[model samples]
Target: MKNWMKIAIGLWIAAVLAVGISMPIGYIPGLGAKARIIYFHVPMSWLAVLAFFMSMWYGIMYLRKKDMKHDIKSASAAELGFAFSILATLTGSIWARFSWGSFWNWDPRETSIFVLLLIYGAYFSLRSALEVEERRATLSAVYSIVAFVTVPFFVFIMPRMMTGLHPGEGSPAPILNANGKMYMEASMRYVFYASLIGFTFLYIWLFNLRSRIGLLSYNNHTEID
Candidate 1:
């Protein structure tokens, strides 16, 4: 198999096996049905944060080096970050519908994620609107760096201050216990961690592919000029 195909297949197999194992473990007497969402939702949210931080890191590099490759990397990471954030929001919304009796309630947590979605969407729009390549990169990089300032606030601060329907805030004891440790059954933890690793690898693979494609397209267009 081609290298990319091999990587893709490996990721698929890992995802499938993880989900299969997670389902049975999630059905264990103590764990319950809601545990299933952990496999998807938690990983999506985690990966989204990871991707955005990566974008910011590359953004800094772009500014320092003024290299288009760094810009491409930053842009690719933001695109993937946006995708993961959307998935996280949808999964959270669905989980809420079943667990909280509504799809959305403008809860601080939900509202913050929605804001993140809008910010990233606007980033893409900003990219599309500009005609000059260097200008587009610089502007978007600045926007990304500024936009991520809200991430820490939204993901960490706002949730803690308000007594929302979400799990983390206003509880003496967190949903996950002290030490931030969770008590997933062995099987579920295995699969859940596997899913996390697989998803991360998939993100890296996709980001590299996207950056390469962008570079190739840029080169082709320049050749035409």
Candidate 2:
């Protein structure tokens, strides 16, 4: 990422935090004041899914081309995806504590996210167990692709299919609803979308920086051999 772009992202996120914290939003049904976390939680969840999808994409590229660069990129994406998933989980759990009066209730959405985390966690374990580079790359790629196949079902379908305290129950959440409609005020909606955009840009920057670091390590090992 360029210096200017990095600075812009920093400023943009600061602005998002400022507005999201201060802006007067209409009363949310179940969550009144705590609804502000939506700006961070939803976006982080989105980027987690996006990162996993990109991991699968690069994995496919590696399988097709047999290039180590794609493998590195795929691994980088998975690492970020895992990190973001943890963040999403933590944020949701905190929200649950206030909204549902407990840290965890095994709600459908919470269970699904937990399952998603286990699946990706195993992916990393699989990568570490293999000693051969080629085998590790191939297996990791295949695992990422197959694992992603379950992502939409778990992240999107399962939560809505079953009742849950984490929204998507008979009642709707603040912004994202399973009924295919968003119920946010105009100003809040704008901030929500802007936050999404800022986070997307931040993800791109982090991904690029991570990919470069991975490539550097890979190249140095190649040179040593």
Candidate 3:
């Protein structure tokens, strides 16, 4: 990201924090004051998915181009995806304590995310177990693609397929419904979307920095070899 873009992201995030905290959310039966978690939790989850997708994208690019830079970018994206997914888990667990009376009730959403985390966790372990740069990158790239295939099923499909405490069918789904329509109050909607956008930009900046670091490390390793 450019200097101006970084400054803009900072401003946008500050605004999101201001509005998300100050804006009075409308009534949500189980959530009440705790509903504010959605602003942070949902967006983090969204970022996890987006980052993982980018990982897959870069992985495919690596396979086609046979470039170590693309491999570095792919690994960077996976690292961010795993980190964001952890944040989402924390936020969701906190929300669950309030809404579901426990930190983890093993709800479908919780189970799915946990499984997703494990899947990606294994991805990192896979990367570390391999020593050869070309072999590691090739296998990691293929694993990234395969692992992401489960992402949609784990993050989107599986939870909804089974009963879950999340805002979805047969429950008082707030903000967004099972059909993917937003029902948030106008003010809340604006702030929520703005927050998501800001989170995305933040992810982009983080990805750029992480990719640069990965590239440097990879280059140094190549030189040493």
Candidate 4:
């Protein structure tokens, strides 16, 4: 990473930690003390979507060029996405336990995330089942591209279409509204947004790190061969 990027990431991390630890905000009407989880949970969910989208983009590139590098990129992004998706689900469930009175409610949002997990799980299984490098890369890239078609539906559409405990169904979103208005107080909103920005940069940094590691491993394996 560039020095500038490193500096920015450091500053972003400080901001997120500062807000997460010290931001003073009143209890939300519905969520109470559990509302603080919003800062972390929302970022995880958003990053999961972003990661999957990146995987799909790389998958498309792999299909076009048949490059193992692109395949590596797609798989790395998917792996990160799968991790974030699990964290999001866990954090959301924790919040749900306090707010909705259950850890697993089988709500539309929960169900959608479960479906997403299964889809990504299958992607990895497909990769593990294939032995030939070229065949694995090609097939996994295709699977990655096709599986991404469900991302939008599971993450955004289905939850809103049916009644659920999560926001976006004409319910009050934790922070910003559809028109970009903050429902929380100004101070809280500022901290919340700071966390969002910080987490986004954090995701970028992590993705870069993982991609570099994948590249290095690939290069080392080829040398050994």
Candidate 5:
């Protein structure tokens, strides 16, 4: 199979695993229904982190290479990151509503992720307002890199420092806490990891497609000139 086809198949398998195994695990006669959101919410948060760092990496590359393609890739990754972040927030909110008695809270993790969304929304606006390709690329690259500096602080440091309703905060152990003590059953872990891999592959596939379309459009415009 072609590379894209392989990726598509892998993603399909992952999606199937997420859907098929999530309920069984959640209904394990004791864990209760709140566990259902885990399949979607956890993967979304992981992908959001992956997407943002990928964007930052490409942004740095754009600066080093002065290649517009790198800028396009960086922007595409950022867009995807923004999307996953929103999904993570929404799903987290739903989970919180059921598990924490509120749909929204002023928790540090919540506030920080929301701030990230705003920062990236501003990024999109900044990119749109500029007409010159080189200027847009340069400005966006710089902004992406700079904004990424906040990601480590918000997603990592701040959450650790403050008390929050979120699970990972204030614990010596990682929030994910996937050690044997808190680990999902083997069968469930299979499905969960599959979902993670699937979403990650999907992100890459979409990024490549977007990058190709961007390159084609650029070429078409250049041809007309």
Candidate 6:
């Protein structure tokens, strides 16, 4: 990775931690201290979606160009997306344990994430089962495209439709006004926004790092063969 990228990553990491930990937040009726988890959880969830969309974009490019570079990019993005998704789920579960009185409630939001995880897992499994480079790249690219079709519905739509503890779903869902802004106090909103920006920078750095590794490994493998 470049020095600039490293510096950017460091700055964002600091900002995220600083805002998340030090920022004063209003106590929620129920969540209180535990509400702070949203700072981390929401950003990871956003990054997971963003990463997967990036993977899908690269996958489409691979199909159009038939370049291994695009395939590598797609795979790297998917890997990061999967990791973020897991983290988001874990953090959400922790928050739920405090907010909902249970660790695993099979809430719509939780179930949606579980299904998304399975879909992403299948992409990896399919890639591993293929030995031929061209075949693996082509098939995996196609699979990623298909899998992403469900992401929007699962991550955004289904949670709203089904009864769940998540925002926009059940009784305890976060309130949003006509402006579509969350009902959080001004201070919490500022920290949440900072965390979102910071996590976005972190995601870009991680994607670049993973893509570089993929490219180097591909180049080395080709040279040997």
Top candidate, metric lDDT: 2
- Model 5 earns a TM-score of 0.84
- In candidate 4, stretches whose alpha carbon ends up further than 4 angstroms from where it belongs are 3-11, 167-182
Model 4, CA-based lDDT: 0.81
lDDT of 3 by residue, 54-158 (tens): 988999999999999999998899899999999999989987887878999888778877876887898899999998888999999999888778767766677
* lDDT per model vs. reference: 0.78, 0.88, 0.84, 0.81, 0.76, 0.82
Candidate 6: deviation at residue 161, Å?
A: 2.3
For 190-224, candidate 6 gives per-residue lDDT tens digits of: 77888888788888888888999999999998999
- Runs of candidate 1 with Cα error greater than 4 angstroms are 1-23, 26-31, 168-179, 183-186
Identify the superior model by lDDT, candidate 2 or candidate 3: 2
lDDT of 3 at 91: 88
For model 5, residues 20-79, the per-residue Cα lDDT tens digits are 554465334323666666667778888777888888898889889998888888888888
Instruction: Give the 10-residue window scoring lowest on summed lDDT in candidate 6.
Output: 170-179
Please, what are the lDDT tens digits per residue for candidate 1 over residues 105-172?
A: 88877887788789888989999999898998888889889988877787667766666876544443
Clashing pairs in 2: none
On a 0 to 1 TM-score scale, where does candidate 6 land against the true structure?
Answer: 0.90
**Residue pairs in clash, model 6:** none
Lowest lDDT sum, 10 consecutive residues, model 2, at 167-176
What TM-score would candidate 2 get against the native? 0.95
Error of 6 at 62 (Å): 0.5
TM-scores for every candidate against the unseen true structure: 0.84, 0.95, 0.93, 0.88, 0.84, 0.90
Candidate 2 local lDDT, 5-114, one digit each (tens):
99999999999999999999897676687988889999998888899899999999999999999999999998998999899999999889888899999987778778
